[model samples]
Target: MAVSDQIVRWRYRLVPDHLLGEILTKRWVDNAIPVLILIVVAAVFGWLIPDFFSAAGISSLMRQWGEFTLIALALMIVMVAGGIDLSVGSTFALGNIVALTLITVAGWPVPAVIGATLACGALVGLVNGVLVGYLRLRAFLTTLVTLIIVRAIVDMMLLKYSVAIAAGFVDSDLWYYFGEGDVLGVPFSVATALVLALVAHLVLSRSRVGWHVLAVGGSRRSAHNVGIPVRRVICLTYVVSGTLAALSGVLFASRLGGAGADTGVGLEIAALTAAVLGGNSLGGGRGSAAKAIIGAIIVMIMVNGLVRIGVTRGGSSLLLGMVLLAAVAIDVRWLKNRHKFLSKVYVSPTYSELPEAPATSGSSPYALNDRLRPVEAIGLGQIDGPEDVILDEDDHIYVGNRTGDIVRFFAPDYTRQEVFVHVGGRPLGMAFAKDGALLVCIGGMGLYSIGRDRSIRKLTDETNRSWLSVIDDSRLRLADDLDIAPDGRVFFSEATVRYEMHEWPVDCLESRGNGRIICYDPNTGTTRTVIKNLLFPNGICMMHDGQSFLFAETWACRVSRYWFDGPKKGTVEVVIGDLPGYPDNINRASDGTYWLALVGVRTPSLDLALKMPGFRRRMARRIAPDEWLYPNINTGCVVRFDETGRIIETLWDFGGENHPMITSMREHKGHLYIGGILNNRVGRLKLDGMDPTWSGIDSYWRRT
Candidate 1:
């Protein structure tokens, strides 16, 4: 290799391409970048102006940023709920007027003044909310009108009472303390802002209201369809925005011991700019209070630094405008092309050279054959991607389809089909619980169960998210397959924590350890991670002895045994490795053996691509998705294995014409029932020596 090539290879190895991808793709990093940039700019300014980092300088910066940060957080809530409050500045002015007038002109107690101020703010928000939420007015237009009307009202009030309130409160001790008080060496206003920010963050991230707000912001129509009270949520967000703005106004007036018409002028623009710069999406559904504070700090640093450098006010305004415009442009572009950018940055795995395999028609032990006989199409054109199959007590076949449904075909020739239940996520693997409920692993939703009446219930949707992960790994991204152990503990496979269900191919390309095995205990109502850092763990099946279960790691083309009881409990060992295809669902055979389905037969081209990480990464970026080479999912076979994990028999659809991609198979009543993800039907093949009267349910639960 050339010296340049060697250097490039070393660089790729040392840094490990996936590390960069994780960092760039993380949401928190996106939110934190503005803060990092602010720090760098502050450092530069400190270098230029030796006093910039002094205690006095820092205190001044904090005092200035306190109210701005509060307003920015208020805007963040509204923006996160897919709305905007253009009237916040006017509301702030109104609040300031209300608090000061009540305290000085009326000689009211401090608590009454504060109450009146907040009440006035809530009333303003209510009006705006009613206009936008109930009247269906555009949020921007409705808030703009509110802004104009409120500003007019505040101006008239100030013109009438501004002089009286200013004189009355000039030497008041209460006003003095509120205006310039310090707590534990921190400015009162700054401390109050920090507390509010912390509370807001908790409400947004940990509460059900926050979830609803995010849902409404993400997609209003969808949120409404899911039974969320969209109008109520929107209204509440505006109320929060208005109340926070009002609080900030009160703080401003108390600190200055006065109120004025221009006190909150231009605050709306500053808050909006700061919120957006902090990573609050103008389009909604994403943001945090912490991010809003960080954005406020960034804006303050730039503005203060420019003033210290003796820039004219107009020039500083121009610079701020330019920065806001640039930040907005960058944010918009990133939101639009985030997925594409992630695809480009993703690093593919490096694989060793694969051993050569025989052709599909070759006379090797793994060669294709005509053992899988064709059967009638079950839900022919109705079901897409019937990935797994199971049988009930009556020999009725149940299969999970691509469209997030479980379709059932009645026994006695298996012709009539009905929708067993709608799961709302791509249903992949399923098993019958001892209580007659159907346990299912939904692709993106999590583990769920369907009762006998077909009512759906969620079991678990999250695990302990790893701190090392760049993305939120709490929610299961791909609950691909699962099986129920004898003790009522549900074991499932989460295929690739880093990618969504639709991005399974990306997980394959990365070939990194991003998958995990999770177990949910019904007795304790707790779910926990059993194993972490597996490579695309797909299908799972409990052993007949109830001591261990076998699960397929699709990307690695291996099956592993996980023991839940006996001396080998909590240990994992490879049962079978280096198969010639990617395995899918595994089920028990009638004769105390197991049946494993290979979804796709591996090919030389794919093997070569896996070995060349650099080539794969480039292909992922440069090639369109449809043009990129995927797994050989067009042809597959079913192979049976003994208790010792040795292949007993291999069955195939020779040309993949009858069944294109076999994913799951179960033996019942002298017949081997088959399912294919891409095929329009389920298949059935007769076992020459099996008993005709033995059903799968009977074999498992009958027990002599």
Candidate 2:
């Protein structure tokens, strides 16, 4: 039992798991709550202020919100890229001053003046970008300094020159159109903001630059490792922020007919509040421009409503500050505990009662015989959790251990032991490629290969995650086992997308189809899913026929065959089902048969719990981890199966003193090599009548 299981059993009873899962699966509903809140607020205000819904009132609201909305959009971009800009308000004021001076005093054409104003704003943003991106300065401090510097410069310029537009331009048609004209019954300023918002939404959600921005914001180190230009993306975000702020300034100056020192004062806080309210994270990597627009509307409504209720300007400002503070606090807490919240609200699969175990009478076919006479203990007290074992051409034995190291034992006497390589994750299933490289499935890191020179490289770690997934399921969570086909293709199993490798038992309790099978081609660098939504698809091994493979679904207690060639290609069929134990690994035996390692034998209580989804859900919530009923992994047995899936011979360590939790067994050169996940040493058993010189590699690759 795990803590998650305990919480599930203790806390929930009345709410069915299926209904809870349905509610939690609707992620879009969470995002829509802000909009719903805004609607409710608007409805309340409209009732209170009879003129709130009138055309005149609506037009006034749009004009007042237009510039702030633009500024909010600017801040939203930086925030989405995992940064922030506090200088937007100052940049806005400066853009207005630049436009006023260039158009009225310099007597420049309106088009050139506008372009120059935007360029200057971009230049300011470029400086911020270089400092924050290239120099690695903190976004908050860098933007704060820029804000002070730009405001100071504007103050000095205002002291020396009057802030006024020329009389000729004040009455200009273009100026009037931007400032107060209407387009299709919508204010030109509002319409322009809407157009920019639409474009920003598309660029943020659909463009490469936007993707890079999000990636960097999500995890800067991961983005850099994946070859994304992290610094450049961060720099571009600041530049975009500056340009948008400048555009807002120009719009405000046009509407007011002149530039003022306080033209954009206090706008930065407003924009930030709006962006945060719209669901933008202060920590970055999540959010949208469209949401920012909605957030801006919410802020504007709050301000307008306060004024309508006869509150003082200062009092309204205080209320807005309080709102921003509350939103930030909620967002931070939510992000930190999102996983815990989701686990409680989702339905896990239910299991039926465990079927009766096969008869194990002394003369029965399923009877366990002690034919395995242990020869010697190899790597004793040196390795931890050698879940799987393999041998090379030179007869060197290799095992992946719990400490994330692949340990190798020298050939012949098999006494000398040394680490071959470190994979930085729990390494499980392994196979030798045709090119002699070692292909391994790392528990949490996905598929990887190590060359002869011991250099490790990642093959793939991503799959198409389901929309209903509560976490980012793109990365393989638990790549349990793998096998290679004759066509040089590597196939592997992701045990459970819903849980990490260590939490495998919890997955058993859920028994949901969260596992998947995937194939990767080394030559073309492509990885794709073969079969999805499986019940803990664990061990995988290519068939002797070379047209199909066998994989065990641990929770389902069944071995299934998947074909990739011949008539049965692209199909799956059950070879065996309703086993007495949960299977872990399947390996080829020397006598044209297969060895299956049962990590745990099923119990009646565990089986009964599986059948009752409601009871299991309650138990998962209420029971303490140490007190809850977990799968019986303490006792296990290995059985040999022929091509027809009929049991041939069974070997058992009933007391589990020699080999507890046998996860894998491989036959080679007249010997059976055994590996256990919880044992300290590897076990080797001698076969009575087999050639002593045979090797596993030679047996599999021999010419037809």
Candidate 3:
């Protein structure tokens, strides 16, 4: 190979699509970049400008940014978690006015004064939280109304006692020193901001509360359903925001030597601008307190620098607005479109190399015996929400359904069937254990092994981190297609913590991509994440060799292979891509091939959504869910794939013209039985010439 070709190969081996393997992708950079750029720009300009680099100039910058930084940090917490507070500015102004009135006129001690100010702010926050969180008021409107009411109250206070504060009755020194004081070359206000920023950063980055906040921001419904104290978290965040705004107000009053009408005026916009520019998203579930403060600092420096360059205050305001607009524009449009640039300049389309079709086509396929035909449709009327089916020694067919019920179909003719046992919640996938016990994947529960006596035993339900939030209905949303390896280790898919069975499509639009595949070792009885952040991971089937497993990503429309043995163990490979439909329950075929069920085909509209995130996210936020925006029941189908990742055959249901939506398909006694959530009766199909090796666990009954 040429030296240049070798260098190219080395680079590919070194990086090789960084997002594929890394557990944590760098999501925070989009928020951090602007602030970083601003800091660099400011430093360079200050170096060139004579007065701009001086200690006095730097102190001036600190004094200017003091109020904005404090408020922005508070805003960052709320915004990052997918929330907002409009009353921050009002609370800030009120804090200053209240603190001044208490210290100067009421003669309260400093501690009492500060406490009173914070309590007042907290009260406003509590009101906002109650309205937005519990009352289910729209966050934007609820906070807007609160902002008006709080501002009116502040104006009333000002009107009642403006003269007293301005005339120096408040002993200005107490407020003045705090705003201007310095220790060891650091401004007191700057030091205070730093301490608070550091503390907030640690709490958000290192604590579990922070994770809850992010989850809530990402999807409030998902968060609440999954057992996050959504109301409490929302309410408390507002209180924190109000308190921080109040702190900013107190400092501002001190710096100005008196509280005035202009105090904290338009501060809400400034804080929001800083939060957005710093990378705290208005949409939520993605933000940092550190970036928010940096954003505020950037805004302050821009305004201060423009003034230093002889721009009028009016011009500076225009320039700042322009700059903020530009930053937002860059984030929303440029960065997302950068993918187009990458495709054109550096590499070919990464999706072109995926497997296209099965090995056999356009030939008259061989047919199995006539016995398989009617048998395939025999269990149709008996199955409801049937996730998986297995056969036992007594010619009894055991089907695991998601509603925590197992249905039994008497074999030879799967005609006599009854609800075997009610396990509670949803059950997805199942496999026959070596001991004749049935291993089941119970959604909202965990892995379970059922005995012949109709009793269920929990194998493993939890993971290493007990601190990780597991909501009640989803204490464990383990789903479709589990397999027991040779060593008795069980592996399955979490599907999505963001959406339930009824709302699976919502997971696609949210695009937070929080699904993971997990493994449970029976010997150790421990569960670990085999692959994290696979987009809407749906199905998991242990490979034929048992050294690796094949799993499907429903949203990504692809199947991936994860290894558990050898040097390449734990590594994931995209075995197939650009699936024609959303892949569902995967099971090992009797022929050593894998049968994959395509629950729904990807329509043109949904496929186009992959390129437009903002549009999809907006729809998620705005569209009435009952609106039926995407194609549903009509396109349900199934596909068969071999071990080589080739699509061998396709089964089209079209929801049976009113009864499609197939989820799980188990080949039993040379027949195919299908079931899904909304289906009233399972679908059955006869394979005339299919291989006899297609018998699944359900075939054990035929042997018996």
Candidate 4:
């Protein structure tokens, strides 16, 4: 290899360029910005303020954070339900006054006062729910009106009860505990808030109620169409917000023991800023308890720190306004452009150098011929994308198609067909178990089987994951093909780990070694990867020797044999290298040979372009997807080869009348059946000088 070639090899091969795209695709990545900001904000404030990290200062900060967290959480809940609660500040003031009046004037018990406070908040929420949800009033205007009405009522109550609240006092242990207690170095309010946050997180993330809330937030009309009670869900979200806000007021009232006229004024704006600054979406349908809590902590720290550092209240509010504006702008742009960014970095192209194509021009072994063009078409226009074909013991033809159905045709005439079973995922490669069970590889699913009784069963959906893999490889992404070993162990190929079944073309364009061969042992019901870093590994066929198997690497355009039981066990060797086209399914021929499907022929232009990864990357970015260069899948052919890796002969569909893309073939009763991934029909060609009694079923399952 040239020095330049070696440099390119190490650059693409060693550097894992796919990691960033993989990380960006995860849902948790959305929290990254808020967490980073939280760290930086804390650092900046701690440095700016004297003794900000002192034991007493930290405890005071936690107390404030705990109360503010509840109010922010209340706002987040309403936002996630596609509504906004502007009256939370007023409702919080109501709870504060209600608690002070009960404790000071009415001499009520602590528990009873708490219940009464919560009830008042719930009553206010019911009014909001009835108007905004049931009456179809806009949330913004309705909540704003309610905010004014609730604040007016709180002002009246405070004016009437303030003198008595300051004059009378009750010394209660429970009230003091709630106000200033500590639990193992954590503040009383902090401990309480953390527990509630955990419960709220579970209810929102891990329960059906949470799903409904998110659904309502995402789309009210769609949620209603899907049988979700849109009005009820929205109403319930407001009630939850009111109840949580009241509870926060309960803590605050206990801490301060009284309220003034200006209590809770402008509190709603601060809570809204905290909620949005934590990365909760303002457009609704996206938020979390963690985000609410993080936002509250940052706000509480910044505000309290600013006050202690001699910054005026107005200056602190100004800074908060700026932060909220910036946060809202970021959330909108990130939502709109995340996928656009992904499209650029996600399809990372790596260096690939396909070997020189063999001479397929006139008089060569692979010279073009219209052998398959005259073949009889089976189930034409009646089937969809039959990717693999097989014969049962009775010579009944079966083929797996893209529609996720296995269609069967009666042998005498191939005109009629019926769906044998629906697999829910596109069925690709297939083989038989010892007892005649049809083992199938389901794309985007995993290995499954159909018994003689027509029962479907999942064999395995996952394998052991690689420790160093950045992305989860345990779950099968696309199981392309499979074959059963003599010991009943099933060997299968996963075409590409990075791309799903629909993105197979993209995977091919990258030409990375994202494919792997996995084996599932029936005896232990365990699956594991046997070969890693294959280039689009497809068809799997247990070699006639019963000790090895022939597997095709579609993009690599080669056939390779893996030994499982012989002396060369745990090793692989190339059987046919440098084919003129991409190989698909490999099956056994009647006379001790192997039949391989060349799904797409190689082109000189494409072969040359594959070696230059930089040019391909530019093409993918600059051109529309349909205009991009793709593998030349225009020619369909099949070649017969021996164990010694010599191509015996080739059959070509020069005109591609029936099999436009030959993906698989089977031989039985002296007739060859062909299947294609892009063709709507299967083809059958009568072979002369062949054994009529020869069948794939007997070839593998018959007694010696």
Clashing pairs in 4: none
How big is the positional error of residue 548 in model 4, measured in Å on the Cα after superposition?
Answer: 2.1
Cα shift from native, residue 4, model 4 (Å)? 3.6
Ranking by lDDT: 4, 1, 2, 3
Cand. 1 Cα-lDDT: 0.83
Deviation in Å, model 4, residue 176 alpha carbon: 1.3
lDDT digits (tens) for residues 1-704 of candidate 2: 55755554444333334455545555454467579868987998989999887998888889878878889999999998889999999999998888777767777777887799899889889999999999999999999999999999888866655534535355367865776887898888788889999998888789888899889989999999999999999999889889988888777777776766777787888889899888888888888877788889999998898898999989988988998898898778877877676666554555444446676666866676555435357888988999999998887899998999999999877889989999999989999887788999999899999999999999999876667655556789999999998888899999987777878888887886778999898788888888987889989988899999999999888888999889989999888776888998998887778889999888878887776677777776676546767889977688889767898888877666677678988877888888888877788888776667776677666622
lDDT of 4: 0.88
Local distance difference test scores for all models: 0.83, 0.83, 0.69, 0.88
List the lowest-lDDT window of 10 residues for candidate 3: 345-354
lDDT of 3 at 682: 56
For candidate 3, lDDT tens digit of each residue in 338-442? 554332222111111123323222451211112212323445555566655555546466776655688887766667788878888677777887677888877
On the 0 to 100 scale, the lDDT of residue 63 in model 2 is 86
lDDT of residue 261 for candidate 4: 82
lDDT of 1 by residue, 24-115 (tens): 76668777678777888888898989999799899888877887788898899999999999999899989888888888888888878888
Question: Clash number for model 4?
Answer: 0
Runs off by more than 4 Å, candidate 2 = 1-32, 35-66, 74-247, 259-269, 282-290, 297-329, 332-339, 346-349, 359-375, 452-459, 463-475, 521-526, 568-571, 622-628, 690-693
Candidate 3: residue 6 lDDT (0-100): 56
Number of clashing residue pairs in every model? 1, 17, 18, 0
TM-score of 4: 0.96
lDDT of 2: 0.83
Candidate 3, residue 211: Cα displacement in angstroms equals 11
Off by over 4 Å in 3: 1-60, 73-107, 119-243, 253-269, 279-291, 323-371, 374-376, 384-387, 401-405, 410-428, 434-437, 441-480, 491-519, 526-704
